[model samples]
Every structure is written in C-alpha cells, then in structure tokens.
Target: MTSIPWLTILVFLPLVGALLCLLSWHSAALCRWLALATSWGVFTLTAGLFAAFRQGGAGWLLYEDHAWIAPLGIRYTLGLDGISLLLVLLTGFLMVVAVLVSWRVTRFSAAYFALLLGMEAGILGVFLALDLVLFYLFWELMLIPMLFLIGIWGHAGRAPAAVKFFLFTLAGSLLMLIAIIGLHLVHVEAGGAPSFALEALRGTALPARVEPWLYAAFLLAFALKVPLLPLHTWLPDAHTEAPTAGSVILAGLLLKTGVYGLLRFGLPLFPNAAAASLPWLAVPALVGIFYAAWIAYVQTDAKRLVAYASVAHMGFVVLGLAAWNQTALEGSILQLLSHGITTAALFALVGMIDERAHTRRLDELGGLWGRVPRLGFFFLLFCLAALGLPGLNNFVGEIMILIGAFQTRPWWGAAAFVGVVFAAAYMLRLVQAVLWGPPRRRDFWPDLDVREGVVLVALALAALWIGLYPAPLLQPLQAPVADLLGQVPLGPGPGGVP
Candidate 1:
C-alpha cells in the first residue's frame, strides 16, 4: 500500500469537514472557509493523484481494500482509473466553485455550506467507489443534500420540484437495488467470492437470457438519474428551482452520474443486452437531442432554456454510448465532461443575471453587454461552447459522438446531427437575447464582481483547456474505455484487452 491512501482521503475528507462544520454551527464564516479549504485541499491532492496515475493500463494502483462486515462478504474497496480521476477532479474543482459562488448566501449559511460540501463528498464517493453496494450507498447519499438544497434554499416552487426529484430517484433506486442483489446472487452461483466489488463482478459471465433484466434494472436506475426523455421531467424543474450552487452541482456532477453509470456498469456488465437495446434506446437519445433543443428555442425563461439544453447535451452521451464504438464511447465520455463544465458555468451566470435583474425572462432582458462587459463575454463564450462552436470543448465531444455514431449507424448519427443544428439555433438565440440587444432594463445592471469573475473565469479556463488539449485528459481514460469496449464482445477489439 502507498504511504497514503490518497483516494480514500479524498473521499472522506469532506465528510470530516462536514462534521467539523456542524460542530461550529454558530460560526458561519468559519464554516464557509472550512468548506472552501477542505474542497481546495481535495482538489490539490487529486491534482497529485492524476500526476501519479499510470497511463494506458487497466489494473488498479494505489488500491486499498479492507474486510468489513465479513459475514456478508463486504469490504471497503477504493481505486481510481483514468475515467474516475477526471470526474473526481471535476467534483473537487466544482466544490471550490460552489463555495466561492455561495459567498453571499446568508440564510442558513452554515447548514447550507455543510450540505453542499456533504453533497460534494457523496459525489466524489460515487465516482471513486469500486464496490457495488458501496456505489449504491454513495448513489443514494447524493439525493438528500440536493433535495434539502432545492427544498429549502431553492426557488418558489422548489418544494414540489424537490419532492418530485426525490420520489423519482427513490423509485428507480428500489428497482436497481433488486437488480444489484440479483447480480450478487449470480456472482455467487458462478463460484466467485461474495463481494460487491465492480472488478469482482466483472469476472462473472452471466447467462445470455437473463442479461436483459439485469441491464434493465441498471438502466432504469441510471436512466432516471440521467432522467432519459420521459423520466427527465424532474430535471427542468429541479434545475430551474435550485439555488446557483445547487444548480451548478446538479448540472456539473449529478447529471453526469447517469452517463457515468452507463459507461461504468451498463455497457461493461451487460454488453450483449446493451447492444441489443440500441435502436430503441437510440430513439429517446435522438428524440431528446432535438426535442430538448427545439423546446429550448421556445423557452422564455433563461434558466428553463439551459435546463432543456442539458437534456439535449445528455442525449449525445446516450447516443455515443449506444454506438459502442471507440470513437463514440470516447466522445460520450468527453461530452459528459464538457457539458458538466459548460452547464455549471451557464447556471452560475444565469443566477447572477436573476440576482441583478430580479428576472430571467429572456424577452424582458437585453443589452447587458454594455453594463457588464466581462459578464457578457462569459455568457457569450459559454453559449458558444454550449452550442458546440468550433474551438470550444463541446465541439470536440459532440463531433466525436457524431463521428462515432455515424460509423455505427449513419442514420442515427444523421438524426443527431440535426440536434446539433438545433443546439446552435437556441444557443445563439440566447446569446443574442441576453448579451447583444439593447439594455431592456439596463438601469443598475450589476456586472460580475471579483468573486463572480473568479467563478466564470475558472469555468472558461477549464473549457479552453479541455477544448484545446484534451489528450492529457483523454489519455488516462483510454485504458478504462478500452477495457469497457473490450467487454462488448464484438466492438472491433479482442475480448479482455480493454
């Protein structure tokens, strides 16, 4: 074992910080700084971990496993591959941003920051947990803080939206729990050690006939979280209602969990079933792409427009996953990263707009560029990134998805291409409405302050870095993605090589 189990430390540090925050309930300033420093500390450590992670390999390094609950064959297992590292970094980075963004939050400030940090910890666990039961615990743990954030600090209708979000996720989680137990039993029948470890379960060769049910259980759980198409009704409301930091994390980390689930478990464990469900799955994926974009074009509320765009962006993720090719899978993963950064920034910017103008109605606002050049610049930059303009991060992800999807099924890719066009339409429309037109009500249109500028600048820099030099970010995941594709059984690679 390495001298330090950095990954475990990264996972639990915030939780420890959260406990400390609770102990200092009366010291709001201390709570805020504590959360920020704790998050920054995690980010700093992960930066070191990324530097240490081996490139182009499939085995766990710095892995720490310990026996716990021996009767049930459970253990505390933690490891990080390329894919997990990026999300962990993203999680840490966004937590720092969340703290910075919430600097002005005065109501229940200590409790709010604690919950937010707690949520960040849970998300970190989701990305890093290597055991199935451990994964589920982190998965459900994510819902509570978010629900409270939305219900308590969220917008007017947040209470109802939070309830809907909770119920939907809980319902799907129940179905997934059964599926997980089923897989556990299957592993037992295969003579494998009783364990919830992902790597352990991957070795179990499931029977062909039962694969679909297992896939369904996993898919439904993730799909609800991703909120694929019909299941996505909860997202717009949640995003629209949650506070800025809540929305940022929702867009940045929570939504990615679904796509992460597909990549991490759905495709790998149930390859044949995943391949079988493509045409049907592709339908919603394609539908969501254009469907969400078109509706976004018509949305009068800026927040809702961004909410719908997330559906559209996630659709590309689904399409890429279904394509099951290297290009598509890589692209899908890239899309996940790109959308996380871009959407988080957009929500933060929108929150600033709403805070200043007391409204987010697109038609009612205009010409803020004159009042706030830096803010306007960020809004335009993020919009271009969101719309997949060349040279931005999303362009790389979306193009890769389209190319990969086209290689598998040209028509599906073609349909997705139209969604790309629709994305541009709405994004450009939003930019023009918010940043180009004459100030509809520019009186005292407050611009980005030092803190606000810090947040948006960080987001933009990430977008630029990922857009321009993605190889560094993408290389770590090559082993994991390749390992995942190798499981597909017929995806142009030898089995077990990924």
Candidate 2:
C-alpha cells in the first residue's frame, strides 16, 4: 500500500552489492570498500524504515506483492510487521559488522565479501517474504553462499563440516518444501483459489488428523535449524570450522531464521498443532540448555567452547518460544537481537586472540589483560553480558523469559535457572584462564586496532542500551504479538514483554 518499494529494495540491495563486489573481484581493496559502503547503506535504509514506521499497528507496516507465476499462485510477496522489521534491521546491522570483521580477509577477499553480501540478501529475503513459495526460495537462496564460505575460507576440517551443515539443513528444507506444497494443495482442494500467499493460506481448513503431520514437518525443519538437542550436532562443528564472519552470521542471523519461521509461519498456520506440540518441543529446548552448557564447560578449545555456548543460548530462545507467552516471546526476540550482538562479539574476540596467539586452546592462552588490556576489557564486558549479568542485555531477556515460563509452568522457570548457573561457571572460568594468569607466551600481542575497536564499541553500546532500557523495542512489539496471539495464544497476560 505504501508508495515506495522499500521492502523489495531492502531485500535486493545487498544482492546488488554482491554482484558489484563480484564485478570488482580483481580489486580486493575496492571490493572491501564497496562492501562496507553497501552494507552501511542497507543499514541506513533499514534504520530509516524503523524510524518512520508507525507504532500501534497489527499488520505489515510496508508490503509488496506482485505476481511471479499467476497460474501456480506464486507471487513475489514481502511483509514487514514488527517482527520482520526488527529481524531485517538485525540483518542489515550485522552485515555491516560482518564486513568490518572481515576487513583483514586477504585470500579470496573479493569473493568473500560477495558471498557475505549474497548471504545478506538471502537472509533479508527470508525475513521479508510472505508468499510460501517465495519464502522457500529465499530459504534456499541463503544456503549456497554459506556453504561455500565454510568450505573455502574455514579451518582444517572445513569440508566435512560444511557438508554436514548443508546436508542437515537441506534435509530440513525438503520437508518444509513438502509441507508448503501440501498446504497449498489443501487450500486449492477446499474450493479456494490456488495461492501460496500466507495470509490467504493461514487457517486453511486443514483436516485435524493431517494438521499434526504438517506441523511436525515444519517443526522438524525449524528444530534442525534451532539445532535443538540431538538434532544439533552439526552446529558446533560448523561454528568451530567457520571463519569469524561466518561464525557471526551463523550465530547472529541464520539460527534466528528457524525461530522466525516458527513464529511467522508454522505456529500461525497450524495453531492447534503448535499448542499440542509445546510440551514435546519443550523437552529438547529445556534440556539443551544444561546439556550444551555442560559440554561447553568441558571444552579445551575456546572457540569450540563459545560454539557450544551458542547452542546453550539457542536453547534459551527455543524454550522462550515454547512458553508462548508475550513476555517469553519478547524475551526470545530480545535474546535474538541482543545475543546477536553479544555472541558475535565473543566470536570476534576469539578470532582476534587466535590471530595473535596462533591458538584457540585455553591452555595456550593466558594473561591477555597484561598485554591487551582494552581487548581483555571488552572481552570481559561481552562475556559478562553472555553470562546474563544484571543491568546487561542478556539479563533482561532471560528474566522476562523466566517470568513468562514461570507463569505458564513454575517448574520450567526453576529448571531454566540451572543453565544460568552453568553459564557463569563456564564464562568465569574462561575469563580467569584467559586474563588472569601469567602469559602462556612472553611475546606481546597487539591491542585493539581502530577497526576492531569500532566494531566492538558498536556491539558493546547496543548491548548496554538494550540492557539499560528496552522500552523502545518492547513498546512496538505489542500490537503484532497481539495479532499473533489472536491466532495462537499460549498463556494469559498483558500484551508487552514485561
């Protein structure tokens, strides 16, 4: 309805940037600057959209729909509500961070930036698309660039790790594709016009018996991406093998797509089935917290430890979704936005240390505070946030999630606290081992350079702002969440995250 094709432009701008990067592949410096400028432009555009966005709306603030294939009822549709808008903003912001973090990338540098931009476009497409077919297309779009990133730029075991990530995700995507087709066919058979439009297909009078199966299909796909419990084996490897930028996007954005899928499509399309599956889904989500944390604590490799920490953090997100209350969902979204900042910061720091020390092994790292005090200080800040320290970003989300869980089921709240304890244990141990003891090697490592400082400061500031006052973010969330609850309400409460 709006005049501008803002959503469409937002979706493809990164892609155009990607193409430009490819065209200039011979000029690494040109590619770097181009990627930086393109990413900043996207972030600026997205920020403008956010600022101009109307509050108190329950539907898309901006929407674009044009026929892609009329006979098949597929259309190029994108919807931006509060949820999609926040995530899109995240995609834009993190693309900037990803580029900045990759500033030092020399080998295949142009291709690397292109792939990052390509991945950005794909991720934006996923967040914006409203047509089932269109969404699926975007889903597939993101996969290839990420696959090559790990395979080409990653560490020693990149090949198998990349393969594992691809296969697991592809397996999930196939199921989701089948479910998409099945839903469209059902709508067609029920005397409705053939359409993959989410708005039209939602509440398709799916047979009660068939609903669970379809819902399960969607859940399996999302869960695998959520990497919930037993299905999560591929994630640690992917995280460990990936480059710094890869790890950032994998943790910050890609994993979020899973929960976003469930929030945007699966639950709304099959509300009854989603309600029924809550307890079952909760099992893995709740358990993954402690399980991953325990494993993280035992890891000697610092990078692998943070990799497992991502698993544990994702467990919190899934559990919040399982609670299905406003506070919990808000917390989950907060965790999504804030965790993207804090965790990405952690991975960036780890990468920085590895760059200097030539090792990510805990035993080989020590007394960094004596050498790079600023670096150690920032590392400590994000680590504290990750551990859910009060007055920090992670705490706000966790507390809200816990409150929401408590309202739904007291035991769920109590059990989740155990994971918080484990977080402190692991994070504290990391801080102590890395910053307190004598240097493992006598050679001095460089402190934060201008580029690294800018990125870390950006992340740190966001974390502090969210922790200090999340009201701005929380306020606009109500109307859309209320709309979602109208479709599938989990527990009784006020509309906002509080």
Candidate with maximal TM-score: 2
lDDT of 2 at 281: 70
Clashing residue pairs, backbone N/CA/C < 3 A, model 2: none
Where is model 1 more than 4 Å wrong at Cα? Answer: 54-56, 491-498
Q: What is the C-alpha lDDT profile of model 2 across 1-498, one tens digit per residue? A: 389899888888888988999899899999999999999999999888878773637777888889999999999998888888788888888889999999989898889999999889889999999999999989988878899999999999999999999999899999999999999988989888999999999958999988899999999999898779999999999999999999999999999999999989999999999888875676898889999999999999988999889889888888888788788888888889988888899999999999999999999899999999999999999999999998889999899888888877677888888889999999998898898898989886889999999999999988998899988777667888878777886556333222
lDDT tens per residue, model 1, 1-498? 387778788888988888888887888888888888888998888777777773636766557788877777777887777788888888888889888888888788878988987888789888877788888888888878999999999999998999998898888889878988999899999898888778788778899877899999899889988868988999999999999999999989998898787778777778788767765788889888888988999999999999999999999999888777888888888888899999999999999999899999998888878888989999999999999988889999999888887777788878888888899999989988998767887468667898899889889999998899888887877878877777775544222211
lDDT scores of the candidates, listed in order: 0.85, 0.89
Total clashing pairs for each candidate:
2, 0
Model 2 scores a C-alpha lDDT of: 0.89
Return model 2's CA RMSD, one decimal: 2.1
